[model samples]
Target chain A: MATTRKSARTTPAAERPHPDATRRSQRSRQAIYAAALALVGEVGYPKTTIEGIAARAGVGKQTIYRWWSSKAEVLLEAFLDLGEQAVHAQGQEAPYAIPDTGDIAADLKAVLRATVDQLYDPRFEAPSRALAAEGLVNEQLGREFVAKLLEPSLQLHVDRLRAAQAAGQVRPEIDPRIALELFVSPLAQRWLQHTAPVSYAYTDTLVDYALHGLAPR
Target chain B: MATTRKSARTTPAAERPHPDATRRSQRSRQAIYAAALALVGEVGYPKTTIEGIAARAGVGKQTIYRWWSSKAEVLLEAFLDLGEQAVHAQGQEAPYAIPDTGDIAADLKAVLRATVDQLYDPRFEAPSRALAAEGLVNEQLGREFVAKLLEPSLQLHVDRLRAAQAAGQVRPEIDPRIALELFVSPLAQRWLQHTAPVSYAYTDTLVDYALHGLAPR
Candidate 1:
């Protein structure tokens, strides 16, 4: 029975399940994601366990173990799915890509304004802060969060800046990697530490200061 | 007896005891500071208690209570003293001001480089990360850390930038509050998130990119 169950779990798409089976699988995945996020937000990362997630999702422990290895793995993928859903809800084309509308400053400001909304969203804030707080003390988890979540988002900016360089909007000699941080890091600092409230106006000012220099033009 | 003990605890400096009593007081203070840092580093902020700190310091619980009302108060003053000790160890003037050599860019880079050293210091890293991790989850503590610890350090940069504005080294139109973040926030992000390695060269690049437009001259 165990052998048969393991085989069923790893079955390929080409082997084709019934329509009912596919629908059930999709529903289970969604339930698991929702349970993981809600549990983490409520109890924080340290207390959140696979058992709790399974219980909350009304799935067997083997069901989660068959899909993912650890709680961190589940949460990471859940956040990625959350970002995709947020983008889809916004009707954005190419959900993860930064926009390049010829004017680098204006484009960057628009995306940062969108980020302000996401950061302040009640659905996103609690779970994100819980995970972020864990990441601060857990080096292994912190590195994973940076690698899977943050670096990809930052790369979008890097790619946009590189394109700006090619179009003569940015200096050819400037390092796109470092240049992106001038605006990106300040907003990140505000969100992570709650040093100050973030706003469309504040991010707009960051882009202006970053592009035009803080000294005389 | 209770009144006598309380009076002894609150004795004014003019009515203080002899030299041996003063030396013993200093020793107890140092032990308490060391114990607070170690306990926070080991068990993290939430689990660390005033009782644990007193036990670890080999002092009576009342000794700690006599000096500080709570663990947060003890840790805050301990961290403040730690910063002062670091500055003194660096052989700089007391209250370690940011240098002003007329070149705003160079001065900012120099100070950030010193900060990079301090952030990576072994003695500072574990306890600081523990407190910071707690701050992310505890809103009240988070605000207190920002207002008491972070804002004071940031205000020094504001003062330096305002001086630069007066000297015509920086654009008068730029808000010194926001302008300082260009150099400061990147280093902060790198440390807090371990997003990247920070060094003198990296900070120097930030100052140059911040002061000169990323577009061609």
Candidate 2:
């Protein structure tokens, strides 16, 4: 993965000054992103340095510093890029937005199921675990990752819930921020802490329980 | 805290014919626990050594090896002892049991609120964070801690939920294990990641949402 990224970075520089240069830059950027993710997964966050990432990507240290200020910044962007790639690989639109087919529960369940697949994917699992483990010990880095990489995704759910509320599907009194966690955090805890296996069925059940109270109706 | 625990440990020995024997033994044990918690919290799990702990405790290396086989065992027991002391200090029964007030929601909210207090308490915060952070990276220690410290407490919630189920309060089909996470994981995430502020209101909302569901009835 790192070698592929490094070679890809140089491809654009070899090309001419027109649209091909732009394409090469795009390819190099993607390569850097992939290298960052792969290296972090292999070495973990603390041991993953910009110098190592540059060495792995076959780029100068200046290339990484020019793009990202720190290792955390690189990883966050790398994760964001990975999410986009995952969406693209799924044959969805480039910047994957949650679909609202006028069925809020169905939309939420579908997204969570997709998330389970992403979490379980071998390519994403190890690096994400490393970054998450570091986040547990490093408060500032944890908060930054949550704000940049996590909160954006969570806000998408919040937006969906708000739309549900407007349609009279969700309770007006519900705090969508916390409401999203009803399903999200359970899956997150299971994945991060090795507390349980995450599956479409488990997340589906979570959505059902969150949408319908655990208590008898 | 170490002084108190050490004094308690030596009380039996002090009662012996040798008047100073009890005080000496108590001091040693207290020093060991304090040293263990501090070392683990400061340097983290893999780096913490029994010899290091003994040296810090002002005891011979054999002292720790005599009681515990590894640093993991010593740290685990130290945490258990700390929890017991925390509960005792709160005037609660040692090995604290969650209250059963028949109203499942109220009981759950109360317990979660107490948990919020404990998670934020300065004495418990740093050391627990250090261990939990290590658990994220070390699967063996993570599972052991979960089984020994977390699961027992989680089971009490399960037992309470079962009672609620029998009382026609909770839905009969609900799995208490997963159901518990709706309330528990949110707080755990906030504490673990510093994603958000945890409070009585937050926990109360979680209980209400977990019981009542987010959708309009």
Candidate 3:
């Protein structure tokens, strides 16, 4: 449940850009993120390169190499930045958690509805699909991405499920890790496999099904 | 839902192989299926070509073209043939359905265990992973593959669930299509993403979680 797969480190502070260059570095960083995302979305992971990212970002190759060691690292941080921007766009703080409204079903439904929106969002679609496709075949990257990008969100659900269990809303015998998947994986399959259309209604139903028994009470 | 995605026909009898060449044609067909699956698994979908399949199968280019129109079509049929082989390997009939033993939960767990075996099988894994990765990015192929390959199996689940509903083992109001995913998609996500290990115990837990509400028994 806890992902320790994020890369070991980035550029050290002592070797970092001075305050005078901080503004310029920040601008360059954003450009690199945009460029990385666009390149990956356009040409896919195998074809995407640090050279392409640097050229598209209008920065020298060393500028990219100094901060991130590989294209994968750049894309990983780019996705993190995208998520931060999405949060900030909604007038939230840098570290946003899934709202725990005390009502387990309602909270889960709300979060899944937001996820449905993210899946449908054009800006998120191409890049996510590209990354997910790469992950399907690339085991190392897949595990790393799931650890860093996916599991954190999943961990939030686990936390919520644990909280629900504390309140006796959920059965304590159920494993929160797997129980959360009861709702999560269905929506994911629908999106990733195009098995069905996604909607708020669909996610709401998932929450309902996960909470109430599928069989007659 | 029934899939209308399969192509109209295989071949016209008049243009088919002559009686004297029937055995040779059968051999060539199996070779083509093997080559198609292996090539796609090795080089992936885009780089995999009809020429590659024919060459690998040791048949002429025209031999492939005479039957299938495109690489996708070849892969699709190859997958179907592979599935039939898996069924036969299990000592099952050509058109196998999930067993309904008057217990919905038991039947679901049984089918999911079989799915877990298929997911683990080397013959099924490589080609399935390759095709699924391609489908993630290729909309046309994704829809077609899901309609042709995945939906048929899902329909079997639907039919069984409907029977359960009639037997009052499932809630009448529950939509079987979505309800089926409660147990099905978790196993799928674990297999697809390697989020966790899969086992018969795990799938059995899913059935229990689904059939008996997560809130309480």
Best by DockQ: 3
DockQ comparisons of all candidates to the true complex: 0.75, 0.74, 0.76
**Could you tell me the TM-score of chain B in model 3?**
0.90
Residue range B1-217, candidate 3, lDDT tens digits: 0232133235566765577797888899999999999988888888999999999999999999988899999999999998888888899764669988998888988888899999889888988999999999998999999999999999999999999999999999999999999999999999898888899999999999988878976
lDDT of 2 by residue, B1-217 (tens): 4666567755775463464765876778778988988987787766788889998999998877867788888888888888888888888863567777789989998899889988888767877888888787678988899889888888988988999999999999999999999999999998998888888999999999999999987
What fraction of native interface contacts is shared by candidate 2?
0.79
Look at candidate 2 and tell me the lDDT of residue A22. Answer: 63
- In candidate 1, stretches whose alpha carbon ends up further than 4 angstroms from where it belongs are A1-15, B1-15
**After aligning candidate 1 to the native by TM-score, how far in Å is the CA of A176 from where it should be?**
1.4
Worst 10 residues of 1 chain A by lDDT: A1-10
> Model 1 compared with the native: what TM-score?
0.93
| Model 2 chain B worst lDDT window (10 residues) | B13-22
Each candidate's number of clashing pairs is 0, 1, 0
Residue pairs with backbone overlap in model 2: B14-B22
Q: List lDDT for all candidates, in order.
A: 0.90, 0.86, 0.89
Candidate 1 vs candidate 2, DockQ winner: 1
Clashes of 1: 0
lDDT of 3: 0.89
Which lDDT tens digits does candidate 1 get at residues B1-217? 3776579768987786778986998899989998998999899999999999999999999999988899999999889889999999989885858999999988998998899898889888889999988888798998899999998999999999999999988899998888888888998888888888888999999999999978766
